[model samples]
Target: MVYCGPLSKACLPCRRRKLRCDLRTDACTQCTRAQLTCSGYRDTTALRFRHETNAVQQRVTARKSTTTIPRSPPLSIYCQARDIFYHNYVFGPSKPFEFLLSVYSQTSKDVHLSRSVDAVALAYLNAQRPSGSAELEARRSYVSALQYTSRALQEPHLAKQDSTILAILLLDLYEKITTRAPAFHGAWATHLDGALALVKLRGDEQFIEPSIRGMLIRLSTNVLISCVTSRRPVLDDLVSLRHTIAAHSLTPPDPKWRESDLVIEFAKLRHNIDTRVLADENEVTFALIELDSKFLELSRQVPPTWQYVTIQVATKSIHHYESHHHIHPAEHVCQMWNTFRATRILLNELVRSRCMDRQGRVNAGSGFQGIHERATRAIKQMATDICASLPQYIHGPSTFDLTGSPSASSDLGSGTFPAGRPDPRYHLPCYRLIYPLFVAAQSSVVPPSLSKWVVDQLRFMADYHAIKNAMTVANLLESGQRTDVGKVYAMLGSYAFVC
Candidate 1:
């Protein structure tokens, strides 16, 4: 056996297999002889010395002391912006941040995606600090992102790449977060259109990568929400993709809520309702009835651990509000229940609206009257349930002393509460409740008192959380109440619903 002094120059496959190789210019002899592909040699210059002889080490230290080795250039503004984007926008509970980070890290050489990250990061910073310099920088980054994206799109192969799609999605998020005015709402939609086009071009087979799957799912979710809010027809491709994902179990059930599946089911049903005019009325009705049955089945499938059964405690106060429930259910349980109730409201509303008489009155003999009544009752009950759940959300445990005792003192002030007790307005779950509250507030059957309470909660969210959307929802609900036009979708207009 001819001995090679070192295996460092051998082809990757030969080195891995511990085989001798004649390291040719292109393919190695050993790899060819073995009928294996040679992956080529690694860069020898990139190898680092972990340990060295004393004399060599001394010489190296002396050289370093005598002449400073040029350090790599500091990270550019764009690079810094990308980091900020990951930390501030990308790394979150809802996002698969680690997987996305890995994907981004692997594709660091992709200029389109890098520029998009910079653009989104700059836009996010500008949104936080709306200054001339920040705006200018953001604009520059945005232009760069657009240019790179356009270049990528021009290439037939590159346009369908995951990196290209991600760039477009990032741009969409940038437009959504930075564009404050209603006039620029269509800007996000345009990017969404571009992303959808790319997704169509790539097809389902390209989504084998987990990161790609996650991104496509998020994009579909955004599109679904937009369709629901705008009363637009859901795309056939999106529906197909959703079913594919569900079938493949690409989106795993969340342990906390397990609501993703239910949400998708509801979205499909809602889409059917939205485009029902195009289908046979009887077929649509039958489909909806079947969907309702499925929903009922799903309701029963809720994990026993997730189910919140309230136990009422007697209190001294005369008011019913003085009675407290002892159950301290998970925040996700409340969120899931609210989602389920909201979906029911939408389904029942569709049935009720379809069964309405020419004068906009529900037909008593159409069997829709009973459905409407049940939905209305459910909405009110859900609203009350949400109101009751407030204590759990606010206090972290359902230990509210409704009898006006000293235990209630912890909830009194705004930000002055001790370490463990934060203001309810600033609680994370409060922000999440906007959709459910809005749904409840829009119900004609909700009592004025309950409606006012919902509005007050929204106001708190707007005031404390600085959520402009909360204020918008509050105003819309108020307008709807005054005008007797309580349709949420009608009032939403250009404002995209996030939740």
Candidate 2:
């Protein structure tokens, strides 16, 4: 026997119960109190090694695999949708949505913001994969968002919060993505109306915060577009918000903000003509001339960096539309040019249609002939420019198969692109093109050949992007129903400002 160490000084009863012992000669106090036999402590002289080598070998054997297979935790549906939402809308290639970066950072802590984001994200995903359970989840989240937003609105402290307003805006986007037909546009319009009310409730103080001020500007643009499509007057509140933003800012406004001002001017002028508030055709023509010149000035005022090079591709090339497509320095610049072209096309059409006499002849006046001739040229040229911008979008990487072979004849627009869906990054450029392309295709002045190409692009968007709204508008255009631009605008309205 080898003496290792001292045994416990306590009696067995005390040690068994985990209590200290007095080690009385007759019996320990703990044993006496329990009336139990004291199991004597072990003799320190008797010590032995008891462990076998097998345990150590077994432990080491468990670690002897060829390699460690790393595992990543699966992300929840909500997290996946949130990431997709931010990628396409907040961080995507559109200038109007860049402001969202300031607000989305706070989303995690706020239920309304997070749920609203989830709603839109899931709805957008469902738009691409209509058969998924994401649609059901999207509806649930949307209702939850609506309930939370309503509760927030009742509290004055929460009503004007940036997250609250952003939730409302996102709910609007959810409506746009999930609703298939333009007939349900009232769903989104109701959201915008609620957002405008919330915006007005903030008063002039809303401009103090940069994030809230940006939301105000974006909301104003949306409202103005709504007014333009609906033939309603530009709201006095939108004008007030614009002036307040300008008054609060220290530096000069950027070119995009100036574009908003121009849009406001057009919206107001449109209202006046429709309501016949300006009964004088001469006065309307004068306003048109002034607005046209202002637009021309804006075109010149944009920075050289914003300008794009127009690349001329060969007619035989698959990328060729009207024998050319634009190569914008960035995606946002491409979107802006399309916007400018669309607006100019619509404005010039107004010039051609409104500046006519009862007999349908151009009214003789100062700058009328020049503006009229320019309007004719501008309509055709702007429409063509809008068409020219299509190939860059239609021929994107995901739009073509790896082998570049056409699919079966039974497949419609499916074989044109790879079977694998690209990331959400590729989605927005095509989405942003829809409204502008629709505007171009709808114009009477656009040559039938170019208009046909634009329609084909919309058809491609429907098949390739899985966008039902695009298909709806494409069918309407092919049907030759040009009566209500508002109906067509409704289909793609949500995409117009954001992604």
Candidate 3:
């Protein structure tokens, strides 16, 4: 063989194998020693430029023909559904799950994760446009995901993976999206329990990793919601998990994390009252009062960044509060504030119910009246504030006119949901509004008109948005059964669907 140049001296075999080439005038010693035939090198000048010939022209002509009309490959229905889900939930304004954007890559390697994502995504799409074929496909994907998750759980190595926990959580979300009834003992709660158990199996070490820590916190929140709604006591294991998270976390806990501790206390108090753990009505009222105070204290402690502007909408367009709406610093902050208001509403409602139940009796006293009056005012105010947050969700940030500067509306009376505005930004916030609006509507202290407005919002969510839980809730409100709307929320509107 003849030497071309220094760079081109490598035999084809050495270049292909990525081995260091010995530039020799004859066969390379490296290839010869390996008993391989040394394929000769190409000309250095030829390597610098393309050699256009009949074959190259033919290939180029064929490529140009194929490229003449550029067409994007058509995405499958599953891909479209997944994209829609991400748009409405993951990458949407709410960005319900912070970890999803990062953990999605794991789906490439984890079959359970991919299937679970597809299952829930398809279910979410079907909620938008209910069809038998879409529903059937979603159900099939869900079943397949569940089978994979069940098999994964039996394998210790696979069971410990974060993707496995996410798969379980996604399945839980699918059940919530698809299940219409308010039952808690089936797949919905089971997945929540399974995800928690897996986290517990991982133990304190799990908290050292930020992603696992996030999932742990999410799992705890879901459990707390489920326990409060179902009237079940917070489990001791969860209490331990929260402590471990606090202890093992590398960063200082944020406002929401601290608020979660308060929520846990509130949940525990609610459970105690629900289970008759506090048999005396006065004792329950006192506990409610105490928890409310703590929640308020934490609310005050949150950084100023958590503060929101309450704006008065100038028009009587009727999509929102009669007088005002709120704008928060961030979507998460808005959600946190709404959570605070809703929790206060629920707490105060409990207080009023307990205090009033003991009213006009031998045990009735002036102190009971004071507590009842305080709770009544709180319920009314919180209900109104929750209403104030609605317009920001419905119209989004752009359409909101903060400069209108109208007087604040004291009540949540608003018009029916707006039509012909199908902005994607509105979807997640509307879904989140379900529970708070349900709470406000169900509150005995809210004016009948405001209650009706809240119900109408739910009706719109049910009718226009096609949210099944919203339909169940709307029906429940119209029936005036005084049911636990929170239970409906936790059972049918899983946190998986929300965050």
Model 2 bad stretches (over 4 Å): 1-73, 95-110, 180-194, 197-205, 314-316, 355-372, 397-424, 496-499
User: Per-residue lDDT for 1-499 in model 2, tens only?
Assistant: 2333456656666877889888787877788888998776655344333354687778777887655778998887777776766666666655455567777775367788878878888887666556467888999999999899888888888887888888877776676566544633365666677777777877777788876677777777776776767677777877877888899987888766787688788888988888889878778877876897898899898897788666553332433455555666667677667777878887888888765678988777566677778788988888778776665566352332323322242131332444554454556677777777778788877778766777777877777676666787788888888746666656565554343
lDDT of 2 at 74: 88
Report backbone clashes per prediction: 0, 0, 1
Tens-digit lDDT track of model 1 for 1-499:
2222332767788878888878798699888888888898766544433334676779988988999679999876655566655653356333423345755763588888887777777765554435566567878878998899899989988888878877877776666556544322365655666677778777668667666667777777666655555444556766776666665564556532245555555566666655664376546555655666666677787777667666464442211222443243455566667667676666655655665678988776656767656656655665666665554444333334434232554442232333442453233445566766777668776788777767766775566555566788888777764432223433332122132
TM-score preference between candidates 1 and 3, better one: 3
TM-score of every model versus the real structure: 0.65, 0.75, 0.77
Report the C-alpha lDDT of model 3 over 419-466, residue by residue, as the tens digit.
554555555667777787888888878899888888877776666555
Can you tell me which runs of candidate 3 are displaced by over 4 Å? 1-73, 101-107, 313-315, 357-363, 401-419, 459-472, 490-494
Candidate 1, residue 257: Cα displacement in angstroms equals 10
lDDT, model 3: 0.74
Which has the greatest TM-score? Answer: 3
Give the Å shift of residue 148 in candidate 3: 1.9
Residue-pair clashes, model 3: 1
- For TM-score, candidate 1 versus 2, the one ahead is 2
RMSD of each: 21.1, 12.3, 15.8
